[model samples]
Target: MNIWVTSWVAADDGVRLWTATTGAPGASWPVVLVHGGPGLWDYLGPVAQLLDGNRVVHRFDQRGCGRSDPSDDQRVARAVADLECLRRHFGHERWAVIGHSFGATLALAYAWTHPERVASLVPLGSTGLGDWRTPARAEHARRASAQQRARLAELSGRERRSAEEEREFRTLAWFTDHADRERAWAWAAQDAAAPHAINWTANRRLAREVDSWPEETVRARCRRITAPATVVHGAGDPRPAATAAALAAALPHGRFVPIPDAGHHPWREQPSVLRALLLRAIRRA
Candidate 1:
């Protein structure tokens, strides 16, 4: 693994976000790696490794997660603001953003609000423009085993869960097969263990906000993004590929790339292919 420097940056609301950077600071194109899960810990060191030689890569634990201080403010808007603060902290004129799942949504929100600050947008395994939970729930039901289904049913009405329980639920819900789940676990195990790194309170709060996000508003903002964009989706991902295609189509300068036989976490399932796609996006930017 390559060495990198870690630091803290204060957001507009005085929240200190934990951040790290790798690769050459003077690189022509800087890329920010945004991890999925609004409340998940930052475990994207491997991602940075993939592109470290060619571009500067930045990763951070968003507010209320990982090394950052816990807070009641978990709004998506606040996340966008934090991203902007990160950009300024780096003193970069503009940078490309690569995000997965919910982080992809945050990347878009940032670009939509400040298009000029974004050099490129790469959204992988992204949630669609509208309510994605309905189809996601249906897909989970169809793919889950009887025991898994029962477990999910039992947890459905519950309002609280331990970090361990939430991690288990996410493992079951995010991956389609045992191999994929194991791979995700192994990837995450490399990161420093911190109690309450995945904040359930913030996760639940932000999830509700995402569920009610307006489709028209998202579409309108997407259409305004003129930065070069690449929307990548995995073939085996529960979220329909059409959602990614639609999002790509919506952007003035966007294209879609579907990875075969892969799930939501393409880097875990097919690192070479994911690396190639990421390199391509960086070049385009």
Candidate 2:
């Protein structure tokens, strides 16, 4: 199959955007894969696997991540709006929405706001799009934060941190590429060496800008989205299963599938299964 890869910075939310496209040009039915971080890098590997050489896809580093410049917490809404610019930039009237983790929240929020432009929705390892401040999600946040500090100290030759500072460091550690400790730790070092403000600002951005889902009250309002929707979760995900189930059930045409032995990062844990399921979703769309 023919394929193309290109990077360009487009204007988004008053910031210059760094975006990349892979696969053949003019893929009639495009799937836009959103990476899970309110501040995470948009990953391309799993999406590449899921595409399986048969279809083309779009993957990019989201704002404040990778090659893109960082902005304030106010950039969240504007980041969501960037989806429209993405679709229109490629001239797709409607596109398939695939979001993982934090991206899943953005995907649901986007579908909720612009149902007319989404032909399909797939949210994996999702945080329920409801008021996302429940105890369970908070725990997931805490767990991810803990891993960050341990990895950070391991990377830099720094002395161990006090328990309290360890807790504080983890809060700012967003979703990191952890396929390998060497690679993951390199990412940790980048954060460690940066002037305290850049990293701390991201944490401040998370606290100041993120919003919770009105899960209980908000689902009733949007019934027009009849898209082929699939919500997949890791059976052993630290995040709550009930919330994932509730989210899938709430969608007018949602299908819920849970992967056994998988954790929050199911794509890495069960790539074969995830790839198969995602391919099926795309074809169905």
Candidate number achieving the greatest TM-score relative to the actual structure = 1
In order of listing, the candidates' clash counts read: 0, 6
In model 1, how large is the Cα lDDT of residue 245? 87
lDDT of each: 0.79, 0.65
Off by over 4 Å in 1: 155-167, 177-197
Q: Write the per-residue lDDT of candidate 1 for residues 52-121, one digit (tens) a residue.
A: 8756899999888989877789898889889999999898899999988888988888888989999989
Q: Each candidate: RMSD to true structure?
A: 2.9, 5.9
Q: Model 2 compared with the native: what TM-score?
A: 0.73
List, residue by residue over 176-273, the lDDT tens digit for candidate 2: 42323234434444434433222244534643554532445447633656677889987766677677888888889888888887666666667799
Residue 153, candidate 2: C-alpha displacement in angstroms? 12
Q: How accurate is candidate 2 locally (lDDT)?
A: 0.65
